[model samples]
Target: MSRQTNKLTATAVKSAKPTDKPVKMADGGGLYLEVRASGGKYWRMKYRFAGKEKLLAIGTYPEISLADARKAREKAKERLSEGVDPSMAKQLERKLGQQVAANTFQLVAQEWLERVHQHDVVPDHYQRNRRRLERDAFPVLGKRPLSEISAAELLACLRRIEDRGHVETAHRVKALCGQVFRYGISTGRAERDPTPDLRGALRPHRSQHFAALTEPSAVAELLRAIDGYGGQPVTIAALQIAPMVFTRPGELRQARWSDIDLDNALWSFTASKTDQPLLVPLPSQAVAILRDLYGLTGRSEYVFPGARSHKRPMSNVAIKAALDRMGFKGQMTAHGFRAMARTILAERLGYPPEYIEQQLAHAVRDSNGRAYNRTQFLEQRREMLQRWADYLDELRQAHPSSSQSSAQ
Candidate 1:
């Protein structure tokens, strides 16, 4: 401790030179000022708490006047005497100040993604939310703090998405922002969310359904045309089996060589659409196609390997394009094969509805009914597939001067 220089006035304080003895100024209470040996003066407060003495620096001399320094030091001492650790108290105050400064919409949005979005959301919702955030929210409010984001700024972002003819997407983005803001509020990062004000700001969007073929005869004609496609062998095989099996285009295209057992007449595949392992019993015609395809593609992993990249499966558009080449563009789609099979197997073939649904890999209501394993009707399906193949053969036989005849 140094001697106090309470006698020094403001003028004397300015003139004070470097000395061993420090000049002291009273800042009220136990706080005092000391002029250092280097002529720079600083505020120092001394207090005893919890059986230990603690020294705290309030501020530098004229930069923080004696009066203010003394007041600050006294406040700290008062807190210390009240069973509070002033050092811990100061650290908490600093942390709170930093949080307040960082409490922007952007910060809260990121926090929401890191905390809630990644864990609580389903895989599809997680991916959709991430895409929405990247395409809409990040471009505008990503760098802006949550507290600084006004309703006008948020509206501008939503309007931008709406202008691109994505009104529904814009509405979803706004709703997601509201969720992020609420998360921020719960986590003590924001006081209020501004996204609620944008409810009616965006234009409503009209819903559109996918165009699909549903008629039985039309579907049969489409299948006949696909069977006559004289494109690549892999394309022909895919088109031939796609209708017969009626699986999703992805599942059909991504069929692997290892999953098929020709001797057992089974086509096992991990279905991407259902996320379940499926076992499809191969019909005699399907087995013949696979046997031919195996001789060509068995060396690789994929049943239909891409021409440009053997490691990857053939493109989804390949089958549809082959169908187009066969002149059945609008009359059929890749998915139309499902309608064809469902209608024919249920109506013309007179197969049970449950068997048809099970073969289609559709979820059935009756669990107590015979298991829906596609292989259950293996023998019947083989017969049915051969009959369908024979029908297609007859169609080609009838069209003597067909485009496929020239190609073949």
Candidate 2:
């Protein structure tokens, strides 16, 4: 005979007091409420799976209620009919959920940053990437599983940045997220990278060229202005040497005295962006300036040590502020010295393009597709820099009004 079901009532369940022993009220189809002597009530469903008897804990009293317990019993019956074990299925679902929680986007991204990204870039570059992710990407997507993050969801995150009128920042954050997703794929935390699907999703941003001066006459005027800068002796020397060597401002300010061979007229160091060795052929003028500055700051590690402490490099804005004070605020900038050299060397002085680019520490390659070694064209570059420095001296000696008037 079949077992009787629906033997419990809500009125009886609420009023039924706990006794010295536990009591169970049957609600049919193997569902029942067990009231313990401790006054705790729980719902359980008894069943037989694969010829073995088992019990499934549905929930607790008042919380599960009589109606909810009956519904759970029907669902468990459906699972049995399909040859699925309800208890085992529930356990598997819970384990999968735990795995998802463990492999969240933020956790995987952090691993990528520490193990991979940090080694590939400079510390400052790595820190900037980390800050971009933390400030924009983390709060919204951090807790979500890497594999579960869809391309549409990623686009939504980037759209927020674009909505704030930071189109360029949005583009950068998108690329940053792409790196994280690719890392996640390699680590098996993600199935695929979704960024490729977002090619046209972001607003295109125009590249903002750094303010630079390319005209020789204008550059001459700026050079003359630099000559008149009444800054500290250390800063004056940097400004003077800046045009002669034309290195990136960061590399110039952070230059270590040990990296230069003043005797050989060469400055050799690893390029920050490419992490490749670069050899800068210092002209006699550049070497002379360094020698004079050495008397004041030669003992310090950084050639242009900060004003407050000799331990740190000068502030990045120090040269910019100096230029502003010299009344070349919009007309020229510290980095303009490089553009000035590149243009004048190729056009005015008639130096080869490859030599100019190589001197710029760019990744210029040979005819056979090999990157030029740091020492490539050493002799030619040495001559070019000397002539370039001498030409600058001529320009500086020429009246500032003379070049501007000649341009007219």
Candidate 3:
């Protein structure tokens, strides 16, 4: 019932057309050469398996000769006899290839970010994590497969950051790698996390504290030096308010005009360190200085707009430079104002530590065991700020010679 012919040659296959039709290969048993309208020749096998006729492609002509095509066709027949579908087997191969590709670190990291975003990771947290990936991890192992990442490679990546004097950042990078690796493991893309062995690997860092002027006389000298500052009005006002308010240099420099209320005598700003909105009750002197600066820079949004760029605020270094110019480089920094206020307000003025702490916006436990509010110690803070300002003025007027002569 089968039409058998002599072995098909390349010329015969090329000259054949759909009209000429296909001929069964004498060597192939049931396999035949198919000639199409496009003059393309293909080898196909026709067989009965499980009471059904099935056709399977061996390969094209020339590339796979008649003999080789028949050999492939015979192998497929053997698989079919075992109840295996060749089409499904090919599909499984393709799926395995895709799985291998998706197991790459770059692919897994992208998938991790997608999953994290869907779970509502806060924007700040997302930004921080993304920065770590871009700065610390991506350059080395981004394109590598997750399973290819060994413990040595991970330790090397973290050590690069450690070499830059950021032990804390190196530790954080190790943590992020662990997170990404765990994500890979959960998705069956990676077999093991490489960061667990990195504990105690980094060198210890020396602890350093900010230099602060704590003595009242030294603080008074620093204030007098700031008062005599011949800098720009914004810089001078920032220096003036730095000791009075004792806020962090960053918070003071980034203060916006909209955050200040001259009429209510309040300087309200979102504290950068705590990420909380704070209401600082301005004393009469602080209010007067703000009024003068407001009239000068009221049109701009920032209280201390940069000289070169109005859109940006003054730099924190500018305040420190002002202190350096006054020859107090090592003795006081812009942050020293907080120490000055804490010392003078608590010891010299005999103000309640709670009231002074609240004024400083330092974290404190309330009477109800709850956190302090933005308006905590409102009345007491108002009184304390005024008293602190008056005390500074009293110190400014008191002279050593006059006080000694009066005592005599």
Candidate 4:
């Protein structure tokens, strides 16, 4: 039973002041008033449970008064009588309170993003996931608790995005939502992943290949249009190199000078999609472009730094906007350069499929079942890339404005 004697008074608690050392006064039962040298007051209870001593924090004084502390002591005594350790009970309460606060879908999803980033997942993947959450998931389910969210509600949120003609985005959102739910479950904020129930619920997503102009005449016209682009010299250089190399726009924009070896005439970096190191054999034309850009942006890290600041790479919108200016708005994507090069190099240039695939960094396997390593066909790739650049020059020369390429 809790000791009924009371030794602390409201007036004494008000008069307590900081000292050189902490002072703790007993109030009876196991409750006491602790005064710190920093002038902080805390209420605590000490008790024995199952042959072990434990401490339970009642609260701060003034917030929890002399009378309330006794009531709390009595409550703890009752718990101890029922074979429950007061300290363990208090810890459980705290954990439950934290779980309650973090139960919301938004909170759980943010936590999931932090874990993804901690494991070195790509920043673009995180940003895209965040965007989908804000657009489709957050408005409807952000504030709702993960345990309380039904599969139907999540499906509705995804269906809304699908209804707007973004089936792929909708499916991606569902997968991410599942990831967040699983994260929450591991953290004790959710019960089960609701995404399993959503299989076949969303409309089937058909992947669309990037529209590209593969014909020699079309590529020539596109080259002429890019050459006449009224933009910064940096953008013109990026546009010129886009067709000359089989690299994704993201890789090109984020290109670092440290990753380029002008002496070796090679650009090497780890590709984000495959998480594999790739060596891009720089052709003479590409090397010339980089050398000229060196004079302008050599000090900066990014080859195509943004116009306003050199700290960041140029925005993907810059490329899209330039393509729009060239009147190939929807007809070409920044990724279309890959398809264009693939088709032309294979069909027109008469390069071997293996050589082209290796240069493109596709996940092709060799006869020995080993994955194509970065330097698998280095010398052959070096020859093929230079040939590809020369072929592009040949195609450009067929245009009426070809002489301007020589003059410029």
lDDT of each: 0.71, 0.88, 0.76, 0.86
lDDT of 2 at 335: 82
Clashing pairs in model 3? Answer: none
CA lDDT, candidate 2, residue 137: 93
- Candidate 2 per-residue C-alpha lDDT over 1-408 given as tens digits, one digit per residue, 9 for 90 to 100: 998888888898888789899998788888888999999999998999999999999899899888888888988999999999988887898899988887999988898899999988755678889999998999989999999999999999999999999999899988988999888888778889999999998989998766778776777877877777789988888899998988888889989999999999889988877778888999998988889888999999999999999998998889988988988788677887888899888877899999998888888999999999988998999999999999888877777668754433
CA RMSD for every model?
Answer: 8.1, 3.9, 7.1, 6.5
Quote the positional error of residue 192 for candidate 2 in Å: 2.3
Per-residue lDDT of candidate 4, residues 1-408 (tens digit) = 755668888888889887999999888888899999988899998888888887899999889988888899999999989999988898899997787767899988887787664355455656777888887898999988889999999998998899998889998889889889998888888889989998899889999888788777778888879989889999999999988886888888889999999989999987766778889999999998899999999999899999999988988778777888889988887889999999988877788888888877788788888889899888998998898888888777775555434322
Worst 10 residues of 4 by lDDT: 399-408
In terms of lDDT, model 1 sits at: 0.71
Give the clash count for model 4: 0
Q: Is candidate 1 or candidate 2 better by TM-score?
A: 2
The TM-score ranking, best first, is: 2, 4, 3, 1
Give the candidate order by descending lDDT: 2, 4, 3, 1
- Candidate 1 vs candidate 2, lDDT winner: 2
For candidate 1, the TM-score is 0.58
Tell me the spans in candidate 1 whose CA falls farther than 4 Å from its real position.
1-133, 136-163, 167-224, 227-230, 367-408
